[model samples]
Target: MMRRLSGLLLSLCLFPVPAFAQSKPCTVSDHPEYTNKIKEFTTESFFSTELVDHLPLSSCVPPPDAFLHHIIGAPDTLDYTKDINAYFRLLASKSPRVKVWSIGTSEEGREMLVAAVSDEANFAKLDRYKEITARLADPRGLSEAEAQKLIAEGKPMYWADGSIHSPETGAPEMLMELAYRLAVEDTPFIQKIRNDSIILITPIVEVDGHDRMVDIYLQHKKHPDKPPYPLIWWGHYVSHDNNRDNLGVTLALSRNMLKTYLEFHPTVMHDLHESVPYLYIMTGTGPYNAWLDPIVISEWQEMAYHEIEEMTKRGVIGVWTHGFYDGWAPNYLLSIANNHNSIGRFYETFGNGGADTRVRTLRPSETSREWYRPNPPLPKVKWSARDNINMQQSAILFGMNNVASNGQKFLSNFYLKSKRAVAKARTEGPVAWVFPADDSRPAEQASLLNLFVLQGVEVHRTERELRLRATESGRDPDAHKEKSAEMSAEKSAGKSPDDAKSKEEKKPAETVIRAGSYVVRMDQPYSRMADMVLDKQYYNVSDPRPYDDTGWTLGALRNVKRRAHAQSRQNRCSRRHRRPGQNLPHPAQYRQHARDFAFPPRFRSHGSRGRFLRSRRPEI
Candidate 1:
């Protein structure tokens, strides 16, 4: 019957049949009563369900002036170039509730706005941070404005950033819409959140990347140097994948902005991104563990975790954590540096394994399938303007107003536990786990000590096959020295395999190279994800991951990127240097570390906390 049905379809395609009456056909309907009915029937067809998804993909188009309009009490648009001019214009106007500033600029020369949304009282106080205006003068660079503004006037602040991933289309629109609703509407809704809080919003962090998208639409041209990462399609892609360089070596945009942001010590922050193939909208596609300490978790739970829990209970969204690499740090949690209590979460408009049945249903529905789902720390509330106020209230300043200085003490305890565990693993774990062991002394083991500290396992070494192992103690205490064959033969025969411990299962006594890549691997793991909140620093890099690139070394696996970049520069120099037999100086001068790139002396004022890091080495 199946074969006959297929054959009939084939026959219809092969032989052109008459649409009307099928002339002389005593067969069309095969029933005397149905012959007339068959003639009256009309044929209409659409793509099959399976074929429908396969059709070209479609994206949601957000309204124009998305970012500028988000600042409530007023809605405005300013060209990326004329942002400062427009900002001052607002400052000069009656929009007492909101003020805008060009807080950071991207690698592409586009300006990112920092909206200071507050009530009249807060706005008057925000004016104290005028150093932001100094940066606009073009000497310090605009990125420094936010910090300089706060520092110069010594103003306390809270910040929210979005669109570090240009493709994380959700946040730009979400945040922009938020800014708009806040600006355009006047109600108890926006007032509650803005009363005590002054929002320092960086709507677009990666302007260089965002411009790539804008370029494709307007100029019909693609930049020669686009960072490589997953795109709309899993198969076709082109990028150096640079934005992940949160450290900022080759790209100065995020790197510089991060430095300035840290100075302000914001209390609230959230970064956004679209999920890649096999990745979660919440996190990467590796493991679902988070680098958070119990204290960090506790803090978030106190403020934001409850909200997420409520949302999950209500089934407004699916559980945030899933997939192998799903567990990782949310960029916004960096608020701790400035004593800010922040929760970073992701939104998934689309699922990882491609669109499922719901996606199909939503294809014709509204575009609010996924938003920020706060699981444990955030209080469950409907996604609305009032919730934004509630979110701001959860900041360190506000949280402190409620918890007092104990908030810091509580957060400190949580971080210490997580940090101690890691420090111990780095100190006592077996040689494999010690990693590029400390090179303080001239011993082989000491030389093996690594200077560069890697995050959770990542592909670093270009060569090596490795695996993971655990033990009751970090030093592999379970390991026993081997006895002579004659001494062990008799006892070995009677011993059960289960009674004997194997290398792999012993509670991770030490971490070892398990697979591809070299020494570069993540020191953090899902098991210790709860530990990330203990310390945000990488032991080596002053900046955070994915944003600061200066911390990476020039040897080992990192050598590949450094070398490739140098080679490119060398070619450019060689071309400009040689003039047909003109000898370009014999010896080229190599600059020292700090001189290579005019990095200001990276220093910190001495304080009691400095005592702990004084030894620098982990006292595990």
Candidate 2:
């Protein structure tokens, strides 16, 4: 018997169990410890008897022989795509709460997936819920009754994206486990979460980079002189700077991900990332932009504080909020959420690990106080992929849980916040920036219009001439003012200035804005984004500093004319009102005007009668 036992032990040791071993359904027995924890979590009085009775007895715990179990034993820095694929497949096959949709393909032709997870009721009416969120984000046509009804039944939509930057390896891997637990776990706490929230997760934003990084890491694993870190590029062409493409959407990955974001119009959005080695004592820490839409900012801070409290309650270690990442910078994808009146935040988890090795030992230092304040006493900091994953997982879960718990308030806030943005635009002049559709540089103006469309700014083509005071049209009023004085002097002398005007006139001419202008209205939900991109913004003019890109007015740089409606216009003839035979300037006269100024003389010449109307918004 001893000889037989020895032989069996040797055989078992030599051949370990496969990652996906048994075909049995996963249950609480696989992870009994979590079941006990769940019980402790739900013991609160708020978790009523009815709720407990409805909870599933068997938690959807992966079997001890499953892929998740195997990964726990291995290092956290392996190629997680295979694990993600396996896990998602399992969820799709068995979990009724989870539904995965392919949003679009990446630049390198990798499939991009967005998983929509909620309770069965919410999942069934997902389209209806999406429409509700959309209307909340843009309440232009929503009736008061419909809006209130939708708010009453609304659940906060939490959107989380993992690993847009390839170096931030923890998020993509951690999200897989997070998705699995949230889908399969049948505890009361989890049930409340699923029922009260709609969770949208994009596992890997930069799919091509993720695959390439994994392949590179595997190839370099056995090399003797292998680098300490993986030689991975996050973006296809732009690499690390790919995150800066939100406003322009220059990359395919950004474009597709943004399209998904616009489609869902989530209540809260979190973009996960990994920080540099040993900078702070926290697992995750970043500050929010101070210059976001004020109403939206208030709502975001409320959610953020709630998240911090939730993290503390959930026993997450070393978390901080509000000071580092500002929402004013429109370049990042998270800023899309900010611009659209959603509570958006960026989470940076500490990361410094190799495919198989833990890198450096990070401890609390004076420098740590500069970036993040520890919660009471700081926790021990040991650098490892496991630690990175835990922190990111904590941030994602607690953040979403806070929003889910207060879904009704969040839903109302979304609509009200947009209304506040519109009100703010009205209070702060100008009411609109009008750019003539017909300009000497029609192609250049057209290019700028396309950029505006990409950035989600609402553009309207004027039907008729919008008559505003020339002094308030954002042009140099001094020039027009001087011309007015000259006209007065000419009138006082009783001379007809029109006939006696010098050939080389130094005086500015009085100008009237024509029809066919593209109006960027300030009283819109996305007014902040519109203003930031189109208006002339000063850099570091005050004590409080801007996070990034202090001075950026793409419209101004492109020499596009912007007629500012500083004061409300008296006449609102926006459509075709010009008489056919009116004294419109000749096409040659427009060409001469274009040449006189340094404007691009690219306007199409119609005829000698100047049927072609070239217009541009004057520079501020």
Q: Using TM-score as the measure, which candidate wins? A: 2
As a whole number from 0 to 100, the lDDT of residue 376 in candidate 1 is 22
* Number of clashes recorded per candidate: 80, 16
lDDT against the true structure, per candidate, is: 0.31, 0.60
Candidate 1 regions with alpha-carbon error over 4 angstroms: 1-94, 127-158, 218-243, 247-250, 275-291, 298-325, 329-343, 350-620
Give the lDDT of residue 535 in candidate 1: 22
State the local distance difference test value for candidate 1.
0.31
Worst 10 residues of 1 by lDDT: 564-573
Residue 112 lDDT, candidate 1, scale 0-100: 60
lDDT of 2 at 319: 59
Which candidate tops lDDT? 2
Which lDDT tens digits does candidate 1 get at residues 451-556? Answer: 1111111112223333333332132111232334533764668865554445236544534432222222112221132122222224333322332222223222
